[model samples]
Target: MVPTSSSTTDRVETFRLGPFVVPRIWTGLWQLSSNAWGSASVSKIRRGMARHVESGYTAFDMGTINFPSFDHQLIPRTAADHYGSAEIIFGQFKRSLPSPEQIVGATKWCVFKRTIPSRAVVLAAVQERMERMGTTTVDLLQFHWQDYSDQNYLSALRTLKDLKAEGLISAIGLCNFDAIRTDEICTSLGQGVIVSNQVQFSIIDTRPLHGMADVCEKHGVKLLTYGTLAGGFLADKWLDEPEPDLYSGNLTPSQRKYLDMILKAWGNWSLFQSLLHTLRAIGDRHSGLSIANIATRWVLDHPFVGAVIVGARLGVSEHPDDNQKAFGFTLSDRDNEEIEAVLSQSNGRTIITSIGDCGAEYR
Candidate 1:
């Protein structure tokens, strides 16, 4: 059964991530890696980090240094250098904290190209991540292998397991891996080796329900989900609003990306508006919670979901207080039925097949 509590300290909820216990809502720093999402100075970003930690949102998800381009977009190596500063900033912020041990830093090492998965190669990758994060041991290192045709990802994982034995990594996880690959890796590596898989799971994008959920349950792995808010489109401000123009200067890169998924892949604007209305009504039933809280609660309600990685734009914008509301309340059966009623009208299930799986859009 899913855990719930009435205590104020237990409001946010906590889950076991390997040997560490982390809050279910992690502060995602993906926005700090790109100016397209808006930028903030280092001092300002650190201050924002302080505010989140004080609010009991101490877990952070950062990107790798000089990592390959994400979202299936190819970026020049020189430009890619600008992408992973979130790790550095997070590392600095952690060091500044008197209780740095309370902070959980989860970063990624995405391999977009095929390479031999020798121990040397894998160690180099881990070392680079360690150097960038300014920590000797990574709290959680999530690996992303772009090509599935190559089976060497298994070997790379074995190397990561060896590194874990050497005290370089506390835990190992996967990012954007589909159900089959996740199952195979966990099976090949044996149980207790893989802790989590990060993917896009939201009310509109319910692809995980198809098969990934079962795989996670079987392997004793949990999901660290992103895009649960659909780039803030699943919030109150978007209700009763007209469709946005992709080319308009108003939308951030993530907003543009999710907007396309909503219109072209998930459903049209009208259907999304219907979903917003349903969520709004449900939120009202639960003491006037925000639409984003209802949406996030839907994802966290799943027993297999370990946490939801909500993006924070640091000093530029943050909603730590509001995000905390996602916890403390569980959705009623009526609330779920109301959500499913609108979902049945959309093309989410079909999108699952068309898109292939959780991370198929990127592949």
Candidate 2:
């Protein structure tokens, strides 16, 4: 059966990531970076993180430590600020996490400068990231590559496997890796070495189900999905709205990118609106659940997916209460058929062939 959050505390659903049981819905800090999703002050970021933890989100996904602005922002003072904020958010209401192990921190092995670095250089990079996050070992170290032509991704994973052996990273996984590549990794590293594959999996993009799902299910690697909400475009706010232009000031880099995916991969604005309206109808039947909740639950119901990475727009937007409702219900066969009915008519039906498999856009 597909994993769901606990019936008593939907906010606290946990799944095994290797030996660690982590939150089913992770709080993503990709938006916490500078200008990527707009400017969020440090104080706001800290409070938002605390609130996310207070609301039972303990798994945190981030990868901006090496960014120029974020590197400067990772001083002792910033850590102190977040420590204080977390104290306030959970100290009075409940016991706060005393150590890094209490809250899972997952970061990426970024290969921005080079497609593949020497094993020593890769080890050094992981060490630097661990220091910046103020943890000795990262719970999950997800790797991403800019170019697929470089076969050195295999060597990189081999290095990560060595690091995992030493307990520097509790688990190793991939980010934006296609199904074929994922299967290759499984063959290269053995079945249980890779724990999860983080990729874009949403109503607008179900490419993971086309091939990645089979490989992951066979190899036992869970799929951690980003863009399940399609950069916030899958919610009720955009239900019947007209399409915003590419250069719209209100759209952040993330929104623009995902909006373009909708335009290119999912067809025109009207088809997207039809999908939204259908999601709204589904939400109406489920105790007035928001469109976001329905969209997220649909992804969660897929047996191959272990968690969904919903962006925590730091202090700007908070949806902890509403997110908790995602585990409150299941999408019935009727609901799936209704959603697929709209999807079949939309261009998303042909996206697998149009765009290729998961992470195909990057390649």
Candidate 3:
């Protein structure tokens, strides 16, 4: 279906998704769908979606980076919701399918990971997705590679390109790949491939600037940044807490370790508090925009970033108001100095080696 842009406050931006356009800032369902999923029944999951769309999030993130999503939520939820709801399924013929204009469904591929299984193996996986999602095609299918040493990466891209040509997918993307590896794929495909690079970009993790951004900019490749809030540590709740050993509620073990490193790099609890305090001061000037909304907006404001993946964990906590604040105001140069003043005391570009790459936070 032809797509139209959604209205947003001036601070927010939108990008074209084939015919569909989506907010550059979106709520990622992975945080909730990560583990507690067996308990994440359909009704409960739908409630999460209801709250998400209500909060103005119109996109999602998934791929081989986390296979649990492909089998459980991604494929199934797509199937259940792709068709029109009972209101139309009961016989309103014109409403037999979801309005293609309504939401943007996106997922990625860990193609470099060597999980393709086989040509048929990969085909069956997405076919199951089509059957389960009940849609003619996936909006975006991102590729992920585990090791660049494997020459099979290009083969995987070829398969994806073939599928897109076959009209089975709308757009293709790459996940967790560095400049070297992305160059390999792009050089192989030339102009016929990837449109976006999903990476880990935030205030703390700026490794993408090491050269990835320039490459993407040259290729017109979009970067969808994650960890903008550094897995919630940038929030006010951490302003007084002890360095957490094991964080609970939607954060994975890697997330806990990642944030702890940030706290350490910031120079112990003292420096962290300084950063939080500065964010609070800057945030106060903006009528209660939390540190998270500020940090996320900073990433959103960056050029070449088509979107930022903000984790969503409904019921336990809802940040629709704070999330909305991201699009309410802009960060000033002085405010950026206040933030950099705190960040200046810390080791920048260290998170990349620690985590390996942007999407390397997985595993």
Q: lDDT of each prediction vs. the true structure?
A: 0.86, 0.75, 0.63
Higher-TM-score candidate among 1 and 2?
1
For residues 10-61, could you state the per-residue lDDT of candidate 1 as single tens digits? 5678999998999999999988877888898989998888878777787999
Determine which window of 10 residues in candidate 3 has minimal summed lDDT. 86-95
Best model number under lDDT = 1
As a TM-score, model 1 comes out at: 0.93
Question: Would you give me the overall lDDT of model 1?
Answer: 0.86
2 versus 3: better lDDT goes to: 2
Q: Any residue pairs clashing in model 1, and if so which?
A: none
TM-scores of all predicted structures = 0.93, 0.87, 0.80
For model 2, the stretches where C-alpha displacement exceeds 4 angstroms are 1-11, 63-97, 113-116
Compared with the true structure, model 3 gives a TM-score of 0.80
- Model 2 TM-score (2 dp): 0.87
- Ten-residue region with minimum lDDT total, candidate 1: 63-72
Best by TM-score: 1
